[model samples]
Target chain A: MKYTEEHEWLRVEGDLVVVGITEHAAEQLGDVVFVELPELETQVAKGDEVCVIESVKAASDILAPCDGEIVAVNDALSDAPGMVNDDPQGDAWFFKMKLDDMSVLDDFMSEDEYKAFIG
Target chain B: MAEGGQNGDLQRTVLHDLHLDLGAKMVPFAGYAMPVQYKPGVMAEHLHTRAQAGLFDVSHMGQVILRGEAAAAALERLVPVDLQGLAEGRQRYAMFTDERGGILDDLMVANRGDHLFLVVNAACKEADIAHMRAHMDGVTVTPVTDRALIALQGPLAEAALAALVPGVAAMRFMDVATYDWDGAALWVSRSGYTGEDGFEISVPEPCAGAFARALLARPEVAPIGLGARDSLRLEAGLCLYGNDITRDTTPVEAALGWAIQKVRRRGGAREGGFPGADVILRQLETGPERRRVGLRPEGRAPMRAGTQLFADDTADTPVGTVTSGAYGPSIEAPMSMGYLPAALSATGTQVFGELRGKRHPARVVDLPFRPAGYRK
Candidate 1:
C-alpha cells in the first residue's frame, strides 16, 4: 500500500496510480457515502487536493498524491457512493493523475511504514 | 466506541481500527468514541453527500424492543401517531408528548408485530427510556444497545444498494425487512434521515463488521462521519430535536401538526393522556404564535443557529431566531431553517437575518430546502 499523511492510499502500477481512501481512514469515518473526484485531464500539483469524499455526517478532500494532470476520474462514485465505504482500497479510488513528479513517491509511506506509522 | 483505559473510555466500533489508521479526527458523541471530521474537513464532507451519497454510523442511536400485547396500546399512549393503523413492516415518525403537549423526543416507530421497534436519537436515548418506563406498567422495554445502525443516503443510493440487496427496488418507502446475508441478521429499512432515497440497516454490533464490509465492497459507498450528517439533514429540511423542537415548543407551533394523527386528537378512544394535548390541540385549531420555515439568505453569508431574524419590511425588531442553518451544498447557496411568527411565515415574505448587528435580506421559503425523495 502507498500512503500520504492525509491517510489516502494508492496502488501504483507501471505508470498509473490507483487511488482510494485508506482502510484506517475509512474505519475512522465509520461509513463512506459520497465522493467527488476531479474531472479527467484536470491539471494538479503535488500536495494539492484534487477531489472530495463525503460521508453521512462529514465531508473530506482527497489530495493529489503527486503533481500531474489527471488522466481518469472514478465516475462510478456518482452512482455508487458506498463504493468508498465498501471498497476504500479498490473502486473507491478518486482519480488517477499522470505523475508530474515521479520522485514524490519518496515522500509517501510504504505499506510497512504506513502500518507502523498508524500504530 | 473507545475502550476504557481506566480513563472512562468506552469500547470502540468494528471500524475503529480503520478510522485510527486513516488519521481520523475523533470526538465524543452520545457516550461513544466517533469521528467528527476527517482531514478534508466537515464543510466539504457535508456538501459532497448532498450532491452525492453519504454513509453514516448512527450506531449511537438507541434501538429498543417493546414486547407483549400491551406494546401497541402502550406506545400509542406515549406518541401521537396512530399506531393501530401502522401496518407491519412499516415505520412512522412520531414524538413522545407530555400531557402539557410538548415534544419529549422524536422517534421512528416500527411495528413488527408482538413488538414495537424504536430507533431514537442518541442524545435523548436515556431520557426516552426513562420516560417510557415511567409511563408504562406491564410492558417489557429492552434497550438493544448492542446494535449498530448505518445509513446510506443520496440520489445514487438505489443503484449502490440494488446489487447488494437484490429486489430492494420492490421495497417501498418506509418499508422494513429482516435481511439474512453473510450469516448475519440485518433489520433493513428503506428509510433514512437525509431527504434522499436510501436505507438504514441495524445489525448486531459484533456482526456489524461483516455487513459493513460487504456494503463497502460495493463501489458506491464511502465512510462519512458525523460532520456531514448535520449538513445533509439540514439541507433535507429535517429537524434535529434539541435545535428545532423542544419541550418549550408545541408540535403545532413547530409545523408538526400533521404528525399527530386525527384519531388521537381527543375524540378517539383512550385519548388526551399524552402531555401538552390541550395546548397542542388548541394551537392546532387556532394556529401557533410562531412556526418553523426555511430562510434563503440573500447573499453568501451563512446564518448560524441562534441568529435572530427581523422583518425586512420593517424596523430592526427581531421576529424569529434561526434554529438550523448552513451553506447548502446541493443549492450552492447559504440557507437556514427557523421559527417565525405564523402570520409572517408565508412563503415570499421578506425577512432578514442579523449578522454583527447588521441585517441582510432574506426570503421565507417552505421547509425542506431540498426536495424529499420519499419512496412514493
Candidate 2:
C-alpha cells in the first residue's frame, strides 16, 4: 500500500491499483455518509479529483494518486458509505484503476513516511 | 476556516480545558476555541442527543439582563414579538430587526419576572448590545459576562437533569425558572436549539466546569460539540444566526414569522413600534417574494452552504442559495435549508442544487426534515 499527501492510498494488484482514503483521512472526516466515484473507463490524470467523500460535516474531494483509467468502483458504498469509516483500507476501496504508468508509484509515500507527514 | 475557534486570538470557554482533556477536536467558532466534536464524533453525538441526552457548552452565547420598569416595553422596540403579553417564567424566540426589515440578530428573550433575560448569538453579541444601548433609554442592558450558558438537550434531558435538580422535571417546554443547585443560583429554561425537550442553564462561570461534569456523570448524558449542534439544529429546521438568517434576510423571508405574535402584526393594538415594523408588517400582509425552505437532496452528496439552487436540472438560472445543510443522522439523508422564490417553496417542488460544479436534483420540502420532538 502507498499513500499520497492528499490522504488517498493505492494498492497495486497486477496492472490495476485499488484506491481509497487512508485511515487518518477517514478519522479526520468523521462519519462517511456519501461517496461519489468516477464512472468506469474514465481517464484520470495524476492529482485529478476522481471521487468525492461527504461526511456529516462537510464534503471533501478525493484526488487520484497516479494517471490511470478508471476500471471499477465499489458499488456497495452507495448503500453503506459508513464502510469507509469502518474499514477504510479493505472493503471500502473507492475504485480500481488500470495504471497508465506504474513508474508514478515512485512518488507515493510509504506507511511510515505518510504517518510522519501527517504528524 | 474550520469551526473551532480559528481566525485570530481565540477566547476560551469555562469548559475549554475539560473539552481538551476529553480529547475533543477543538476548532475556531465565533472567536472562541470550541469543541467541534469529541472522540465519539458528530454522528454519535447527534444520535445520542435524539436517543438520550447531550450536554453542550454554549458559553460563547452572550447572556444579558435587562432591568428597569420599562424593560418589556424597551425590548419591544427592537423586536416584533409581543413582549408585553409574555408571561413571567416563559421565553420566546425573537430577532433584532433593522430599519429596512432585515434581521440584525436572532435571540431568546425570557421574562424573568422582575427583569428580562436575553441570550444573543456569540458573533453578534457585542454589536447587539451596542445597538440596544444606542436605541433604548431608561432600561439598563447589563451584559452578564460572569455566567456560562450550557444546554442539556434531548429526549432524556429531563430525566438526566431531574436527577441533579429535582424541580426541573416539573417544568414544561418554554418554562424558565431559577433554582438553587449546589448553593449556586442556576437559571434554567426548558428550551434548546435542537428540536428536542431540553434545558439551557445559565451557571456562574466558576461553577460551569463542575456543573458540566456533574451532568456528564449521568448515565444518560454525554458531551456534544458545535458540529453536532449545527447538524441537530439544521435537522430541526432551526436557524443559525450567521448562516441561515442574516442581516440581509427578513423574518418573513426566513420563515420565522411565527415568532411574531398576532399582537404585533397589522391590526394589533401595538402594531408598528419595532425597528422594521413598516416593511415587516407589509411583508406579513403582502408576503415576501422569496422564502426559506427545506431541501432534500436526491442523492447522498451533501449540498453545503453557498451551494446554488437552480430551477431546473439544466442549471442555467439560479433561483436560490443553500444557507445551512448537513447529513441529518435521524433523517438518514442529506438535508439543507435555503432561500427560494415563494412560487418554488411548495412541498415536493423539484429543484436542483449545484454542488462541485454539478447539478444534483432536490425537492423543496417543508421546513424541518424531521418532526420536532419537543416536550410541550
Off by over 4 Å in 1: A1-119, B1-11, B39-44, B266-271, B312-317
Q: Write the per-residue lDDT of candidate 1 for residues B1-376, one digit (tens) a residue.
A: 2322341486566667556654567677767778766655565666556555666778878899998787877887788778888899898889988867778889998887668899998889999999888887788899997788888787677676666667576788899877666667788888888788888888887777666666666665666777677777888888889888888777888888888888777676655656677787788778888998899988555677898998774575788999987667667666788999988899999888886566888899887888887786
What's the count of clashing pairs in each model shown? 53, 7
Candidate 2, superposed: residue stretches over 4 Å from native:
B1-8
TM-score of chain A of each: 0.91, 0.96
Where does candidate 1 chain A have its weakest 10-residue lDDT segment?
A28-37
User: Which tens-of-lDDT digit does each residue in B37-143 have in candidate 2?
Assistant: 99999999999999999999999999999999989998899999999999999999999999988999999999999999999999999999999899889999999
For each candidate in the order shown, give its overall lDDT on alpha carbons. 0.77, 0.91
Per-residue alpha-carbon lDDT of candidate 2 for residues A38-88, written as tens digits (9 for 90 to 100): 999999898798888899877888887888799999999988999999999
Least accurate 10 contiguous residues by lDDT in model 2 chain B: B1-10
Reference-based lDDT, residue B104, model 2 = 94
Error of 1 at B213 (Å): 2.3
